[model samples]
Target: MKYFCLRLLLQSVSWNAPLRTACSSQTLELKRMKLPSTFQESSKRFVHQVPATEFVAFTRSFHGTTMGALALTSEERFHEPFELVMPGVTFVQYGSIEEAKRTIRKGKTAAVFVEPVQGEGGIYTATKDFLQALRTFCDDAGALLVFDEV
Candidate 1:
């Protein structure tokens, strides 16, 4: 009776056949690559060659799907409402540090994803004060500050 019950329990659990097949066919390869110990350490040495726009799109997709909507810049390009592609993402104008602060304070933002240097968005760069203010605001609000450095 115990054996039968155990078999039934196992059968009730759903199995991912594709995942199992892929795992069985693939040979795991472990490769070592050097990475900085911390974000500060990495910032000092590394400047990603990949355009920040690419990272922005990737970030949008990731956050949009995984975490529902996101707090984004108010730039026209990012003004699209939540839909099939960008489910819950909303773009709010991040014109100034004060404006950003107000928006974040008002909303239950999961994270504030921004590019320090706007690549496609007129190549504008965030000032030191602005960046610092954002960091502080996010810290205070208990929201994540995601910098799309790429």
Candidate 2:
């Protein structure tokens, strides 16, 4: 393969990994599912009694095609098919700090998912101010800040 990161392309296989170990997609799935869910579950189960079931995602940002991820996406095409199964997700204009503030609530927001550089809708990069504001919002709301680097 060309490289591990480009494995999805199935071009070539590079040798001499940082560590000699086997890998699988399950590893990535477990890692991905763990981080975001942990904050929500821990807060509701152990710390805060409020259930942060809602999420804040950027409009026009494409997270994925999966049910949960598709719900977070702003595109209507992907969500139209699985509208009933998709969870509720709040969307704010990308890079709009003020809009995000209005959408994210302390007891309601479970997590804020964003792609620093959006690729699907367009190649739009998040502003430093927007990211910094998100950090503060997550901390104050006791939510997790998840960056989808895909």
Candidate 3:
């Protein structure tokens, strides 16, 4: 399953020439493999802990993109004072999407860190509309969207 997922992710990248062919052949090889039932079950359980789609997205965004600054939807609990996290990271409690949009625009935040479903902050889940708005805002502003599942 890990190999399958890796193949899919590699295919998504716009690689040139030999790299693309290599990934395609690797993907076909993985598809031909027949794993044991026990291994399949273990793969399913592992994916449940971190969904493949989310994991791929996080890794791609973190490694593939460059960001000048980071804006978090919520406050950092572990890092007191927050500035210790980095030089350009900031936390904002924008009650509305508009406010967040405005802040990100004005502050020129290169990325926004969000948790679709908050587990530590009382199990709060972000609305689909809010997430969508953030997506649009980031797209228009040329900023990366980062999700923190952990």
Candidate 4:
């Protein structure tokens, strides 16, 4: 009876075949999208009531399928159909610290999302220096740094 119940429970949880990152990575994306307000309310980073709504994403990077993730994505082929209303996002050139420096802003940008190894987007990898720069940028800008490793 226990084995039958366990099997039934497992079957009840329908898992997606494509983009299984939905289980974990998407949660990080959601947090990235919504944590600004929390930070504002708590007065942890900044005292302003208005939360920073802007986000930074890498060009040609794939985060996940959540609404914010869809917005962060650069490929039209992946998210054009859904067209879900999402938060503001700026797409910086992938692996280019120059573009990221230009895009991230203090008191406005909320977070920066990146994948160390962009497998779906042609398996490109980020350099150690590039990531280090992003860390500095986020720290100076008071924005969250989210690394999506699926």
Q: Write the per-residue lDDT of candidate 2 for residues 1-150, one digit (tens) a residue.
A: 000111122123232131113212112221223343332333223222336777788877776655666666788887566557646577789989889888888888877777666788467766656766876676678665665543
Which candidate model has the greater TM-score, 2 or 4? Answer: 2
lDDT, candidates in the order shown: 0.37, 0.58, 0.38, 0.57
lDDT of 4 by residue, 1-150 (tens): 000000111222223221223223222222222332232222222212336777787878876665545666778775565344654667789989888998999988877777666767476767667766887787778776665543
Best by lDDT: 2
* RMSD after CA superposition, every candidate: 19.9, 10.1, 14.7, 12.3
Q: How many clashes (backbone atoms < 3 Å, residues ≥3 apart in a chain or on different chains) does model 2 have?
A: 3
Judged by TM-score relative to the true structure, which candidate is superior, 1 or 2? 2
Best by TM-score: 2
Candidate 1 overall Cα lDDT vs. reference?
A: 0.37
Model 3, residue 149: distance off in Å is: 1.8
> Model 2 TM-score?
0.65
Clash tally, candidates in order: 2, 3, 0, 0
Residues forming the 10-long window of minimal summed lDDT in candidate 4: 1-10
Query: By the lDDT metric, which is better: model 1 or model 2?
Result: 2
Worst 10 residues of 3 by lDDT: 56-65
State the lDDT at 34 in candidate 2.
34
Q: For each candidate, what TM-score against the reference?
A: 0.45, 0.65, 0.45, 0.63
